[model samples]
Target: MTAENVALVIGASGGIGAAVARRLLDDNRYSTVFCVSRAATPPSALAATPGLRWLPCSGSPEDIAAVRGELGDDVGRLARVVICSGILHAGDKGPEKSLEQLDPAWMQAVFHANSITPMLWLQALAKGLGRKQHCVIAALSARVGSIGDNRLGGWYSYRASKAALNMLLQTAAVELARRAPASKLIAFHPGTTDTALSRPFQGNVAAGKLFSPDFVAGRLLAVMDAATADGTLSYLDWDGQAITW
Candidate 1:
């Protein structure tokens, strides 16, 4: 790994995102690990980590652009960018179980968090990521996003948002293939991790399937390391298995 390479983790206030940032810092691969999240500061556990920089972001266009500007020339040197921004539930609004529960506002919010936000960040980082050095860019996606694998047919907003995210990444991969041939894009599903995002749904997860934040972070890093810069968007699981699109 190049000593000058840097990494960025968006939504680093979350469990998986924080863990990924910590792992990257521990690996000693990146010279700096930028953690962007809605929170102004990191969790107490991560605040003391060296080589870690916390940047507050609200996922807005202005905020995202400002964060990129904060990178300055380091933008071109970014080796890894992991976008963990997504919303499964908010307050009393949870994943819908049926068509009757669908709400336009909720759907809009989910789409913004799961799809548009990532695409916005991708747009902002396109030039910097279009360099010759090998780079791996990953976005946190869910298995429920797969159109072909949908059997239960619930959580309409969440599912559709993630599916839209996959499409955005797929389309972006095609363009980046020409502009950034040395870069690889990945849509990663970390499964049902034991985080606040999954806390309410953990009861239904099968045994041996739910994972810890640290375990998922390690596996994600391993999967990304094994990925080749083929200019294709890989929708993969924690174990590096490709999921049906």
Candidate 2:
């Protein structure tokens, strides 16, 4: 949209989220940025930005209400919303695992963190997105989430949860097309970034395969900027290559 637009970034305490905020701020395009995270303490960088607002929320209805109270109703009708909230449990990785070794608790944790949390955010904020013009809602998803690309089969819980997230975003896109015809909803795959989430799994990645958070953030911004509210939900890699459903 322009330097005058407002952007809301969820999970702003983390690497990718923080990087995206920085990129948005540096461009001088976004007039204000809302950085939301569950962390009790705000990040130093986010807190230091002049037009940036660090919001603390537990992703509950009550917490979201509190955030809205602090930021006011006008902030809800933002031009762009980026969701970077996600988690991968310790045991959710690895190529081979037997049913006996899988922990139901771990699976539930992964699903809650990776899939359900973002859905709640969408449900809570859908109405706030301005209905008069085009807006963008982009959520961080993963390539492993692609059911059609699961050749090597691994990371059962994480993969399954992301797949669920893709479904949710796609469905949301369809509904938004009718209700808020100007808003585009998308599911994004940031590829193998050099962040805490991907550090343990980078051994097999090529030298340039693991991207910096800033790089991924920039590419994501580019993708979102190019997207139209045509009910075409995308699952794409860092290079903007579309991943199969």
Best by lDDT: 1
Model 1 Cα lDDT, one tens digit per residue, 8-127? 899898999999998999977798999999998899768888899899988889998998899887878888889988899999998999999999999999999999999998998888
Predicted candidate 2: what Cα RMSD to the true structure?
2.1
- Report the lDDT tens digits of candidate 2 across residue range 1-245: 55667888999988899998888776666788888999876667666777787787998778877776676664545777899988874554532255665677788878887898888878777766656657788999998999999988767888899999999889888888777888888789998888888777689998877899999999999998888778768787777788999
Clashing pairs in 1: none
For candidate 2, the 10 contiguous residues with the lowest summed lDDT are 89-98
What do the candidate models score in CA lDDT, each in turn? 0.92, 0.81
Q: Which stretches of candidate 2 lie over 4 Å from their true place?
A: 2-4, 90-96
* TM-scores, each model vs. reference: 0.98, 0.92
Tell me the spans in candidate 1 whose CA falls farther than 4 Å from its real position: none
